[model samples]
Target chain A: MKAVGLVAEYNPLHNGHLYHLKMAKQITKADVTVAVMSGNFTQRAEPTILDKWQRTKEALSVGVDLVVELPMQYAVQPAHLFASGALSLLDSLQIDDFVFGAEHPDWDFNSLVQAENKFESTDFSKYNATYATAFNNQLIEHTGISLTEPNDILAFGYTKAKLKSKLSVNLHPVKRVGSAYHDEKIDDTSSISSASAIRKAVKNGSAGFESLVPEQTAVDLKELKDVNDWNDLYPLLRYQLIQAPLNYLAQTYQMSEGLEHRLKQAAQRASDFDAFMRLAKSKRYTYSRIQRVCLYALLQISDEQMQIKNKQLYLRILGFNHLGQEYLHQIKKTVKIPIITKVDQKSRDGQLQLDYRAGKLYEQLSGVEQDMRRRPIIV
Target chain B: MKAVGLVAEYNPLHNGHLYHLKMAKQITKADVTVAVMSGNFTQRAEPTILDKWQRTKEALSVGVDLVVELPMQYAVQPAHLFASGALSLLDSLQIDDFVFGAEHPDWDFNSLVQAENKFESTDFSKYNATYATAFNNQLIEHTGISLTEPNDILAFGYTKAKLKSKLSVNLHPVKRVGSAYHDEKIDDTSSISSASAIRKAVKNGSAGFESLVPEQTAVDLKELKDVNDWNDLYPLLRYQLIQAPLNYLAQTYQMSEGLEHRLKQAAQRASDFDAFMRLAKSKRYTYSRIQRVCLYALLQISDEQMQIKNKQLYLRILGFNHLGQEYLHQIKKTVKIPIITKVDQKSRDGQLQLDYRAGKLYEQLSGVEQDMRRRPIIV
Candidate 1:
C-alpha cells in the first residue's frame, strides 16, 4: 500500500487544511492518507484551539483516512523536536510518502538539512545569542534564504529529522495558498485565510470565521473549547509558576541560562500570563519562547524526560476510517511501538503517561471531558 | 492593661461574629480584644470567602482591637492543629483573658480541661476508631457530656493547647446563639445566623442575608472575591493530585494509611471536587477529613514542614486600632515571636513561608490580589 503521511495541527481544519489533505492524496496517488495531528498542546507551545479528538473528527470529515495524535512531548515544542516526533510517528507506520505546505516556492532541502546538522554539532557557548538566532544565521549564510516563514522553517526541520531517522519516505512540498503565515485577520482581502485569523475571529465572536473554515471545522469549532489561548490558561500557569521556584524550574526542560530566576521573579510579580510574559521578556527570550517555557514549567516536564521523548514514543489512534483500519492491521506486526486506544493501558512509557496526564490537565482547564472509554472516531 | 484574646475565622465577620466579639469584651471587661484570625485558608481547610485584608478591615471596624493572622500551618488542619496555632498566636501577645463560645452552656471549663489531660495520658490502643473518637469517648466517660458541636470540639482543643502553652490567659465562655453550626439556610427562626448559612445565602445570591452579617461585612462583600467554594478550586487541586503520585502524596502533611491512593484514584475518575470527595469518602474518612487531606495535597505541605510548625511561628499583624498599637507597644519588649506588618519579613520560619505561599495560592484561585508590599489595615 502506498501511504502518504502529513504532519499538521489542523487546529480548526480550515479550507487550507482540507486543500492540503486533498493535494497530498492526489499528488502521491496514495492508497491511504495519514495525519499526525497536534494534541491538546501544539508545536507553538500553546493549547490547540480544538483538542486532538475534535480535530480528529474534522480530519476524518475531510478526505484523510487516519489521524494520530502527535504526542504532547513533541507537539508542545519548537520546530526541531516537534518534527522529530512527527517523522518518527509516521515512520513507525511505514509511511512511504510525506506531504506538507511550504511558503518558499523553491528551496534546497539538502542544504537546509546540512545547515541543521552543522548547527547542532557546533558548540553553542561560542555564541552569546540563543540557538535559534545562531541557527537562523547559519541558514542565511548557507541557503541565502530567510526561511523564517512558519511552514518554510518547519519544512526544514522536517527534512532534517527525516534525514536523521533514515526514513524512506518521499518528501513533497505543496505551495502554501492564502494569507501569509502571521496574518491574523479573517477575510483580510483574501478568500482563503490563515488558521490563526480564523481562530482569532472565532475567539472574538466574529461571524467572519464561519465562511473561512470548512463545514466540519466550523461545526467542530462551536462544540469544542472556546479558545485555548494563553489568557485562558493564566490561572493554572500562574499557580504553577508560584509553586515552582527558581530551583524547581531549573530542573524543567528548556529552563537554562538563568531563565529560571527571571521566570520565578516574573511569576511573583505578574498578575497573569501576558503580564508574566511582559515581565520576563528581554532581548534573550521572545514571547513565544517564554510561553513555551512557562508551559513546560506548568507541566513540570523535566530535561531527562524530554530526552526520552526526543523521537516517536508510541502510536495513539485518534480516529481511523475503514482503509486506515485495514492499513493499521497490516502494519501491526511490524510497528515499532505500542499502540494505545484506552486510558487504562499501563505501558509505563513516559511519553504515554505524560500524554494521559496532559489529557487530564486539558480536561480540567478547558472543562471538556473525554471519556477514557471512548473509541476512536470512525466514519 | 487587660487584654482578651479570641480565635476566629471571621470568614465574613457575620452578625454572629460581631455578637461574640461584643460579648467577649463585655464579659472580660477587657481593654484590648486581640483576634488571631485565620488567613486565606480556614480551619475548615478551604479558602476564605474574603481575603484576609478585607476581613481585617471589617474586623477592625467592629470592635476588634487587633487582627493577627493565624499562620496557615495551623489553619488548614483538623481541630487539634488549628487550635494549637490559634492559641499560640494569642499567647505570644501575653493575652490576659481568652473568650470563646461554647455549646455546652453549663459545663465547667476547668473540668473539661482536666478531662482532656486524662484522655491524653490514657492509653488509646483499646479503641479502633480515630484519636478523635477515642478522646471523645474518654471525655464522655469523665464529664458526662457528649460534646460534638463544631465550636465545642475546637473549644476543647483550644483549652488543651492553652494549658500546654502555660499562658496566664483566663478562659471564659459565652453561650452560642441562633442556628446550628451546620445549618445552611437563612432566617431559620433565631436572629443570629450561622456563618455557614450566611456564606451560603451570599454564594447563592440570596438577598435575605443582610440582617445576618454586620454592616461592614455587608459593604466589604461587594469588594471582596466571589465565594471560593471547592468548585472554584477543582482545577488546581486536580492538577496537584495528578502531578503527585500516591507516594508523593504520602509525604504530604495530611496523607496517611493509604488515603493518598484513594485520593489519587478518585481524582482520575471523579469529575469535580464533590465527586472526588464522594468517591473517596468512607466511614473511616469523612467529607471534612478528605477535604483537609486534599487541601494539604494541593499545598504540597510536607510532614517535615508540619512538624517544624507545630507551635507559635510568627505574628502577622493584619490590622490594629490605636488601643492595639498601645498594647503592642506595652508588650513589645516581651513579645515571643517576630511581629510582621510587611510581607517581606524574613522569619527563618517555615510557617511564615507557608502563609505567604498560601496567600499567593488563595489570590490565584480567588482572583484577589493582595500586594506583598501593601500596608496593614489600621483604624
Candidate 2:
C-alpha cells in the first residue's frame, strides 16, 4: 500500500514530465502515483501554456494515476511557497514517499538543513539583495557551491517544507534531465526538453516541439488556440493596477519597498505588457518578483490574506485511473479535507476563493470556456 | 463676458461636433465657450477613441474655448446623471447658458417637467419594464409623443436636471443633422455625421471618414494605433465578471434583478466579449444597460459607492484658449473646488479617483501613452 507523490506543473504534459512520472513510479515501486500539479497559473505568475484539466487528461494518458490541483494561491508564488504548498497538499493525502526532480540528488540535506537553521539574520543584513540571493551567498560561503540551480533550490525548499510538515513521508530525489530551468532555446537533445523552451516555441509557432512532448501533448500544444501568457493578461493586469489605489496595491502580498508607486507609474504609461514589465523591473526587484507582485495585485491577495495560513484545503481531483480511485477509497477516512471532483457555489471558501478567481481569470485570459459541471477524467 | 456651456463626449471631435460648437457660440453670442467633455470612458461605458488630452487638443483646434472633464463617475452613466453631473459642474462655473443638440427643439419642457414631477412610481410598477421604458411610457401618455428618440430623451434628461439644479442658465437646443445615433453605415451626407457612424467607419477602416470628420480628426484617427471597442475590453470585462462572486456582483451599481447570476453564467460559457454581451443581454436589460453594468462591475463601482454622491470636485481643465484663461482668472476666487492643472499623489481622491482610473484604463485599453505631467493644450 505504498504511495509515491510528486510536485509538478506539467504545463503541457511533455515527454520529459512523462519520463519523470514513470521514473517516480518505477524507482519507488509504489502502488499508486500522485502528482500535485499547478493549475492555470504557474510559480512565476504566468498562466500555463495549456490549462489544468487538459494537462490532467494528458497526465492520465501518459501514466500518472492521480492528478490534483495545486490551488492557484500557492501555484503562482515563489519557489519556496510553491514547494511548501505542493508538499503540504501531498502530505494531506497520506502518501508514504514523495519524489522530486533535482539538479544534484546526492546533496547532503542533513548538513544543508542544519546550515539553513543556523543562518543568522544579522549575518545576512550586510548584503543589499533579495532573501534568495542572500541565502545563495550564504550557501556559497558554507560549501563553496551555490544551490542556485532551479531544481536544487526547489529541492531545498521541498526539504524545508517536509521538515515543517513533520509528516511520515520519506523524501526521494531523482536526477533531472534536459535543459536548464530558464533555458530559452531548445537543444537537439531528443526527448528531454525544458517546459520553458517548449512554451516559447509553441508561442511563436515554431517546430521541434513534436519530438520533445508526448504525442497527445504535442498535438495539444500545436492546436492550442490560446497559449496563455503575459501578453494576454496584460490588459487585465493594467486595468486592475490603474483602477485600484496605491494604498490598496500596497496591501497586496510582496507590494512593499514603495513598489506600489513604481507599479502605478509603470501601469499608467506602459503601452503593453512587456513595456509594463520592463518599466516596473528594477535592480532591487527581479522580473519574476515584479510579475508575482502584479499577479498578487490583480488577485487582491493582500499581505494579511497571505499571512493567514490556508490550513484546511480540499484535494481537487483533476483525473484518476482505477488504481488512483482505489487509493482514494483506501485513504478516504485518513485524508484531511474533502476530496472534490466537482465544485458548486456552496463548497467555495478559504483558499478555494483565490483558486476560483485565478481559475476563472485563466478562462478569461485564455478565451477558453471550462465546464464546472464536468466530472474528473476517469480512464 | 457671457459664457455658453455644452456637455459632450467629443470622442474624436469630428466635423459634426465643430458645427455644433460654432452654432452654440454664434446662436448664443457668448464670448467664451465651455465644454464639459467626457474623459477616457464615454456615456456608453466604452473607452474613448482617443485619450482625454488628444480629444482636448482636437476640441481646442476646432474652436472650443475651454474643456473641463465630465468626471468619470458621471460621464459613463445614464442620460439623467450625465446631464445632472454636467449641469452641476456648469452651475459651479456660473455659466450664462447651456446649448445642447436635440431632435426636437420646440418640445414643451414646462408641461413635460410638470408631468415628470407628477408621475407616480406605483403606477409604473404594474408595467414590469425598465425605469427608462416606464418613464418614456409615462411621457408618451401625457404628451402623445413617444419620447424615444435618442436626442429627445437626452434633452428631457437635461431639462429635468436643469430644473433640479434650479440654475438661472438659459437652455438652448440646436438642431441635430446627418446620421442617426445608432446608424452604422457611412452615408453620402457631407460634413455632419453620426458619432456612431464615424466610430464604426474608423473601427472597420471604412472609407468616407475624410468627408465626415475634420482634417485633424481624420489625421489623428488614421495614425491611431488602437481605437478601443468591446473586443479589446472583452478580456478584462470577462475576467471581472468571472473572477467575482455572484453575491459580490449583486452589489455593483447596476447588478439587480438576478443580473449577477446571469452575468456569472454568461461569463462562464461566452468565448469572447461579443458572445458574453449577447449572452448577458435580456429582454429586461438593453445592450447599453448590459454594457454599462459590465463597466460598473469592472470598475468595482458599487451601488453604495454610487449612492455616495461625489460632492467635492475640481475643474480639471484639459485645454483652454486665451479667452477661457481670462475667464478662469476673473472667476478664480469664485470657482468651486480647486482648479487642478497638475495632479500629484495628494490630489488623487473622490471623483478624481474615478476620473484618473478611467483615464489610466484608457491608456491600457488604447495602448497609448499620455504624459500626465505635461500642461493642458493651450490653443
> Best candidate, TM-score-wise?
1
Residues B1-379, candidate 2, lDDT per residue (tens digit)?
8999988898778777877888898889999999999888888898888788888888888778888988877788888778888888887777999998888888886568778766667443477677678887777787777777777778877888877767788888878877777777777846777888888888888888887777778788898866678887777777767665566678888788788988987876787788887888876767878888988888777787777745666688889999989888878898767787876656554546666666665665665444356577898
DockQ of each candidate relative to the true complex: 0.53, 0.52
For each of the candidates, the C-alpha root-mean-square deviation to the true structure, in angstroms, is 2.9, 3.6
How would you class the docking of model 2?
medium
Model 1 over residues A1-379: C-alpha lDDT tens digits?
7899999988778888878888998899999999998888866677788777878988888778888888888888787777777888898988999999999747877677776555444466677666677777877776676666878878888888878877788888889998876788775566689888888888887787777777888887776546767887777777776764456578888888888877777777788777888889887666677888877877777887777766447888899999999888889899879887765545432447777777777887677655366668999
- Model 1 chain A: lowest-lDDT 10 consecutive positions: A342-351
Per-residue lDDT for B89-173 in model 1, tens only?
A: 7888899888888787567756787876666554534554666666678788888877688788787777778777776778787
Cα lDDT tens digits for candidate 2, A197-304: 888888888988889888878778878876668887787787777765566678888898789989987877776788888888877777888999988887777887
Report how far off residue A193 is in candidate 1 (Å). 2.1
With candidate 1 superimposed using the best TM-score fit, by how many Å does residue B112's alpha carbon deviate from the native? 4.0
Q: Which pairs clash (backbone N, Cα, C closer than 3 Å) in model 2?
A: none
